[model samples]
Each structure stands twice: as structure tokens, then as C-alpha cells.
Target chain A: MLDNPYHNKTLQWLAYAAVFLLIGIVPLLTDDDFLLNQLATYGVYGLLAVSISLCWGSGGILNLGQGIAFGLGAYGMAMTMQMQSQAPGTIPPFMANNALETLPIFWEPFWNTGLGIALALLVPTLFYLIFGGLMFVARVSGPFFAIMTLAILSALATVFVALQPYTNGVNGISPPTGLVIAGTKIDPYSSTAYWLVFALLLICTFTAKLLTQSRFGLVVRALKDDPERVRFLGYNVAVYETLVYALSGLMAAAAGASFAVLTQYVSPAQFEVGFSISAVIWAAIGGRGSLLWAMLGAFTVQGAQSYAGDAFLNTWILILGFSFILVVRFLPGGFAGLAELLLGRLASLRGGRREEFGQAPAKGAAK
Target chain B: MANALILGISIASIFLVAAIGLTIIYGTAGVINMAHGEFIMLGAYATYAMQTYFGLPYFLCIPCAFVIVGAIGFVIEKLLIQYLYHRPLDTLLATWGVSLVLIQGTRLTFGSDPKYIQMPGFLSSNIELGGVSLAAFRIFVILAALALIALVWFVFYKTDFGIKVRAVTQNREMAAAFGINSKQVYSFTFAFGAGLAGVAGALFGVLNIVLPTMGTGYVVQAFLIVVTGGGALMGSAIASIATGEMQSIFAMLLNDSFARFLIFILIVVFLRFRPQGLISAGGSRR
Candidate 1:
């Protein structure tokens, strides 16, 4: 009825499945523990990129302060893990170093692992619901929304720095390189940690895929095309937009939580505008139109940086900037578009109807 | 107390100068111009290069920086911004890309080192009046801001070109039907805005260190000014003055960074209540 709402849904899902499978088997295929850990780290980043695509791509919301969501999640995990390492009522190490007499009141509840994980997902969602909801309800969209998010990113990072007593200042909160349970320190670098990250990535990818394919997703996609038409059709556009913003926040928080567990650290840098812009760039390069490609784009960019950044630290940013321009100007479909073209050509040569695989009319959301 | 007040005005003037160009470009072209700060950065670098290599005086570097950066802005408008005017978000991202390229290009050329422009001796001296001592350069900046504001007013309100820009901005199709070339108006307005940014940069280089990344530091404030001002000359001026004074007073009472944080929070709250900013330009709210 919606004209096959999803373009090549079967093929897209298959592509996602194949990529997930490939990610899943990497650890098993390689004896290199270091490489495994690196990919695991990238797996967390990939989740952030997917969250960007989920909002900017599917939901037609460009949230440039996505790092703030990640930062909230990471800080949640870091605080919990930090408290776990310390005896009850003792000041955290960083605070103690700063000569704070006691642990801050906010840090008191984070001692519980369950509360920490809950807060990791909840804090960012709450922020997005309120912040994004206010903007959407007030009918502020387009570049204005983008700038507001950018401002939030800048402000949040500075706030993190200014609130040094709670955030450990610019030095950030780094937990010990282990998980604390009851009274024992457990190695976080173990295979269990790696698998945990991989599992979360898998869950998030599938969850997003499922969510974007639902009836609500259809309405949301329609909202992107024409808000007036959707509103006239009796949909509360603000509530739906806010819900998608919160969902994106949840995804980002998940990535942040995993990032803290993997790195044993949470820094104010996570809230930086550069970090947020990188997520946007990843989404654009991977084609904001597809969540799977967005995830791949993050991995590709991060992987390339890991390998080439050491030698061309300065040139890397220039290259990234240029590629972003080229993509936006000439290849709006991004890497996903390139893939679709190749596959479509192959299908046509095999005598398939062109209309069946034709590119859907570009949505009005971004294009 | 008086010193702090003067200091506030000086800070406001810097934001006002940088924001004016943004206000004009955005108000006329409906383009957000994300590279506004980078244009400022280019101006500073351009001044630094001229001063060091060509033995150009600081006074002369201001106009030279304008022409140099204005040309670049003109080229950007013609090559990139023209295509994305219909798509606001794409223009935002494309301009962001342009900013990144400009910043990194400057870094590669200038090697990330901070450069300073030499000040005229009289301008660098401290001026004392009524028990308040202020840097002469600060006074000059304030004067320059007032002068530029007056100049912009004269150009926008009185000139034939200003009428063309206004005509195009008000109703593009009608303006075109009336034989005005919207394309040239957009290009000139963009370049003029960019030239203003370059002048702000030349002034800023004297106040602080000039680095490729320095644009970032000023761009946020400039953007806030433009947004709060609602993308109008008067609105931007009032917004910059308000934010500048608020920041200075807060800094006097609290830490500088804390003051900034508070101002940003206030802006967020203000935007939530008034997303169209302090002044709405009527009709479409794009």
C-alpha cells in the first residue's frame, strides 16, 4: 500500500545480515587479540554512526550533538565502575586528588551496576525527549535544528570542563582497567568483554532495523517527506519526532556504555563538537538513507584513520573534509548508493525488470 | 567596575563585527554559511601573511584581508552554495566541509602556529579616562565597530546595490521579473558578508592569537549572535551587545568558563521559548 515503503528490503536485510556475520566471526578467524580488541572498539563507534543515520536518515532529524548522548552514557558507566572500585562513602580518586572531601551526591546512586546501566540508557533519552521535543513542538526544523544541536555540543563540552569537581575537569573519569563486582577486580580485556561489545552491536543493529521497518517507521518516513500532510492525516508529528530522537539517544547511549567498558575511561572529549560532527560525516558518507551502510562507513573511516592517521595526521582531516564535500555534492547516495547501482546493473543484465529495482524517488527529508 | 563595563562593550563589539556579515548573508541569501568563522580565520591569516611578507601595515591589511577573503567567498558562493540554496541542510553540511578544508588547509600552510599582527604604537597604548583604564586597541575596535555599522547602514539603506540585494531577498521571482539578476545579488551579498568577516578577523588577530583552529573559538559566539539576533543587522547588534555584556558581568562574578557555560545554557532556554530568535523577519521562518 505504501509502495514497497522500504527499497529493496530483502536485499538490504541480507546485506545487514552478511555484515553482522562477518563482524561476528572476526575474533574467531584471527589469533591477533589486539586486532580483535581494535575491531571491538570500532564496533562501538559503528553503533554511534547507526544512531546518527537512524535520526538524520530515517527520522529526518539532524542531531549534531549526538556525542552528548554518548558522553552521558559513558559517564554513567564510568561513574558506576568508578564507585565499584572504591569502598562505600570514600571519595573517587579523581575527586580526592582535587581534594574534594566526599563523593558528590549524584555519584551515590551509581554504585549499583543496575542503576548505572539504566541511567546509561535513560539519561540521554531523557535529554533528547525534552530538548528534541521542545524544538519539534515549537516547529523548529531544518538548519536551525542542526545549529541548535551544534550549540548544545559546544555548551555541553564546556560544561563538562567547567564542572570539574563532578566531571573530574578536563582530565575526565577513567576507571581502573577491570570490572568490579562485590569486592573483586576482573579484567575487562578478556574475551567476554569483546563478545559483550559484539553482542550489543548485533542487538542494536537488528533493533534499529526492526524499528525502522515498523508501521511507526512508515509514518516517520512520511513525516520527513511532508510534515503538513502527516499532520493533516491526524498524526501528532511532534510526539513521533521526539520519540525517534529519544530512540537515537538510546542507541548512542548503548554505544557509549560499551565504549566505557572497553576503554575504562570517559573523557569530556566525547562531548566535543568534532566528535559529534564525525558521526554526522560518517552517516553522510555511508549514505544517511541506510542504517547498515552508515555503520559500515564508521568502521571504514575509523579503520582507515587507525591505519593512516599515524603517518598523515594532518592530511587525514583534509582528506576527510574533501571526501565529505565530494559525497554531498556529487554522491548524495554515498557508498550505499554505489552498491545499489552495481547490484541494479547486475540484476538488469540478468533480465530483471528495471522498475522492480529502480531507485525510489529521493525523499524530501534531506535531498 | 568601570573597567569591566568597558571590557564588556569591547567584547560585544568583536561579536557584533563578526555577526554582522553573517546576519547580512543569511538574511539575504537564506544560506546559513557555516564557514562564516573560517572566513574570519582567513582574514586573520591573510593579515598575518601580508604584515610579515609584504611589509604591509596593520591599517592597510584590513581592506586587503577583505578583498582576499571576499574573493574566496565569491568563489564559494558561485561553485558550491548556489547549488544547495534550495536544500538548507545540504548547504550546512557542504559549508561545514568547506570550513574543514579551510581550517586544515590553513593548518598545513601555517603549521598550526599562532601568529600575531603588529599593532600601531598609539593603538596598543592604554587609554585612561574617568578613573577607568582600557587598552587603546579595545577603544579602536569599538570605534571600528560603530564605523562599520554606520557604513553597512549607509550601504544597505541608501545604495542601488543594497536595493537590489533587498529586492532579491524580499521576492526573488518578482525581483527577477523586474529585471534584477538574483544570481549576481546573491554572489555579491555573500562576498560582502565574507569581506566583513575578514575585517573582524584582522581586528581579532590583534586581540588574540591567530591559528587555523582559532576560527572555531570565535565562530560559536558569532553563530549564537546571528541566531539570537534572528539574522538581521539590528537584531545581531542587539544580541551581540546583550550576550557580550552578560558574559562580562558573569565573568566578573564567576569563572570565565563558567560564565560562558551559563550564557550558552541561557541561549538554549531562550531558543526553546523563541526559536525564531529575538526578531522574526516575517513570512516564512526558514
Candidate 2:
């Protein structure tokens, strides 16, 4: 009988689970508020990263306009918070600056927190539903899909900049006072905010894990591998693509909400093409197919940029650009694949025998 | 009204020149060349460097700009893009990186502030046609753009090299099997495209502020035009002028932001109905 002590897939999953748990608690162990705050920001970015991985990796749909979804979420949250901070029945600072005498029609519904969150998630989802439905139904894929999403992003940014009365143009909207939770004020910069973000990150990751392991995930993977084959099997490929795209947009909105609560400000600059491209870089740098790796990639890349300070700050774009090149050139499987490759090599060195773990090691390694 | 027409034509002329180059390369190579805008930036900077730093005459500096920037494009194709043709996404990523590097490099070499390109004395005066007055330079820019287009048309439709280029664009492997030098044609075509963008930049440098970040905005507009025009050289030329006229007329009637929103909505709707574009050349996968 073959020695199979190390062949349990559950143990492999547990190992990944443990790493994520440790990452979750790192803020609690550290006493530094700044570090904790940074971790919280990374948690928000992690949420977005997971969103990208879920749709792009599993569905083989690379969305280059994720920033728009993030912007929708941020704006939704910011509008609500702004409404709350105002004296009851008074115009908010943004509206006042724009010389609006009365509350805008759209701002009326966002007065309630529940409605705000729902709108934040629903707006991006609906936007994707219409866009994804049209594009997916037409069988748009590859570079065409990338370009179309980019066009949508460009249009969205332009609209935000042009609609100064509502969006404050380039000035963007600011967060209200710290988040109010059941009569207790929670300072966004406080440890409590960090814990809330941490909880959301965990929930997002678990949800993504559950999703990727489901039958739907299998269908998505199947479509990625061979669209025609999946179609022949009587699967509605367009529906699958649209659902994944909408789900990804929803997750992106959630991340944006967390970001607004954390940063307390939202701007048109935040939704630039560069921001969308950065999400792609994050997913590309992390192994695309793996959720934990995507989060790790987001955290590590963003953390490095944050710690690098002003001198290295301007060079961040160049660094990201080159990092993307290097990753694409050598580490086609991204960091996760690199790690798995190293582990495989180490395993081979330990015993002069080949071992198989979780699907084929080579399959899905190229992203 | 005449001045508005002149201004619209001048704006359309600059976009037409750049868009034509972009369409040619995109159609032939199936490469989007995200760095196409960077070439325009390079041209603008090259002209600035020659005129300001080297003390060259305005007329002499413009052609120099084209040559220098075209050379850069040639080098970029041979060193970077040639290897990336197999992987379209990789090309997009790598060129995007190149664009960032070029923009920052320009910002570092020349300060982030906008630079001015002085117009020659002859091209500076206003000429009156009927009751309306138009800048002499604006008329000259339109004429120059038309001349360039005519020249390109002649080269493509009236020469063996053009035939080979079209053949290669239609089928690269088949062209190679037929003993056509497809690689050389690609390099030359890319260089030609960059040269056109350079010319557009040189002309635009006189009409507008030349800044490192200016390329991004224009490039996005050019991209929209290319997609709207059906990704063909003729399509881009006609669509660019039409789009410019629409934008200009809309701007006259409405706020700039509202006009922009209207155009965006129209493009989105247009794309929904005819994803292949108004004048698709039949080879585009989209």
C-alpha cells in the first residue's frame, strides 16, 4: 500500500485556513494603531481581490473595470454617512457646495443605512447585470471584453466628473462621523473598525471558498476550460458569466463600502483606470484560481507600497508595472503557483518519488 | 459659426491623424498598442526639446519630432512587442507599463508642468473668410492633415508594399508562405503609424498645452473613435470628424460635462446595436 499520510485534501485546506486565521489576528497582536489601520485597509483591498478571483479566475472573465463597482459602493456608503452627519432636514456639505437648494432625488432614498447598503450592493450589481447580460449574451470574450469594461469605466469616471451637482465632480464625497452601531459610535480609525473589516474579510473569504467548491464553480471552471464543450452539455454559458460578473461586482461594492468607512472619503481619482488595472495586477500576482493567494497578493503588494514611504511612493506605478512584467514572464502561475512549485520541489528532494496532490499540479498553474 | 467650424475641423484633424495610425496598427497586427498614446507624447516632447533646448526653428523641429519618436516606436516593437504577439493580454500589460514609464520619464525630464510650443509668425495670423475670421494655423492644420491622409491612401492603395501590408494584415502565416517579408512589413507599418501619431502631436503641441498626462485623455477619446469607427483607417477618419463635429455642436449648446455624457451614452448604445462598429473591415474579432 502506498504511504498516504499526506494525501488528505482536507489537511491541505486546513493549512490554508490556518494561514488566513493568523492574518486575521495580526492586528490584535500588534499594539501600533497605524499598523493596525493599514491592516484594516488591506482587509478591504483583500475583499476586492477575492471578488476579482472569484469571477475572473473561475469564470475566465477578466474584468478591467472593477474600480467602477468599487466607486459605486464607496459613493453609496459616503452619501448615506453624509446624510446622517447633517443636521436633520439640512443640506449636506457636498450638496451645499454645489448650490443645490433641495435634496437631490437620488439622495432621498439613501437617508437610511439599510437602504444605503442595499443600494451600494444593488447599484453595481444592476449595472453589471445590464452590461454583462448584453456582452455575455453576444459571446464577448478575451481582449474585446477587457476593452468594453475599460470603456464602461471611462464613461463612469467621466460621468462622475461631469455631474458636479450630484457627485461633487473631482472633489468627491466625504464620510460622515464615525460609523454608528446601535447607539455606540465606532471610530473608523479605531481597533473596532479594524475588527469589523477583519470579520468582513473572513466572511468574504469563506464565502468565496464555499463558492469555488460548489457545482456552480465547477461549471464556471468548465466554461473557462472549454466554452463550446460546456454549451454542448446544455449549460447556459451566458447566464453563468452574467451571474459571476454580478456577484463579483457585488463583492467589489462591499469592499468599497468598507473602504469608505475606513478612509472617510471618496473621489473620482479613486475610480481611475489605474485603480482598475491594479486589481488585475493583484489577482495576476497572486495565483488567479486560489482565493487565499489572491488575498495574500493584495495584502503583500499593498503593504509594501504603504511601507515604502514617499521616496518610493512615486515609483509605485513603475514598481507595479515591472512587477506585473516579471510575474507574467517568469511566474505565470503567480505567487501561489510559485509557492506550490517550491513545495513540490522540496517534496521531491525529500523522497526521490513523484507525488500527486489536489488535481494535477500542472493543470490550472498557468492562470 | 465659421470660426466654430474651423476650430472643430482643427480638433478633428489632430484626432484623425492619430486615430488613423492607431487603426492601421490595430487592424494589421491585432495589437491594441496601449502605448500608442505615448508615441504622441514622445513626439510632443521631442519637438519641445528641439525647439526650446536646441534652439531649432519651429518648421525644422516638427519633422525631427516624427523621426525621433518613430524610431522609438520601431525600437519598442523589435525589443518588446515582437515577443508579445502570441499573448495579447501580456502585450496589454507590458505596453501599459511602458506607458507609465514613458509618462513618468517625461515628467522627470521635463517638469510636470505644461510646456508651450510657439507658432511661427506666418501661421499665427487670422484670415477672414466672408464675415467670419479663422486662424491661419487652423486652416493650415486641416490642410496638412488632409495631405497626410491622401499620402497614406496613395501608399496603401497604389503600391506593391501596400498590397503586401494588406496581405499580411489579412493573413500573416499565409503571407509568409507566399514569401512576403511579413516581419519587415510589421515593423515598417508600426513605424509609419507612430510617425503619424508624432505628426499629430507636433501639430497639437502648437494648438494645446503639451503635458505628460495629456496623452491619456486624448488616447481614451481616440480609442472611442476607433471603436465607433469600426477599427478601420477610413472608418476612423470619417468617424473621428463626425464625432468631433457632434462634440463641438453639443458643447456649443450644452455644458461640457453634459455633452460628454451624451456622447458616452450614444457610444454605449451604438456599441450595443453594432458591436462590430459602423465600418468594420471584417477581420476584427469584436
* Number of the top TM-score candidate: 1
> Candidate 2 at B46: error in angstroms?
0.9
How much is the lDDT of residue A75 in candidate 1? 91
What overall lDDT, based on C-alpha atoms, would model 1 receive against the true structure?
0.85
Candidate 2's C-alpha runs over 4 A off are A1-12, A344-367, B1-7, B127-134, B282-286
The model with the greatest lDDT is 1
Q: In candidate 2 chain A, what residue range of length 10 has the lowest lDDT sum?
A: A358-367
Model 1 misplaced stretches (Cα beyond 4 Å): A1-6, A181-188, A345-367, B1-3
Question: What TM-score would chain B of candidate 2 score versus the native chain B?
Answer: 0.92
Reference-based lDDT, residue A344, model 2: 58
lDDT (10s digit) by residue, model 1, range A48-153? 9999898888878888789989999999989888877787768887786777897778888887888878998898899999989888998888788888888887
Tens-digit lDDT track for model 2 on A230-257? 9999999999999989988988999998
| TM-score, cand. 2 | 0.92
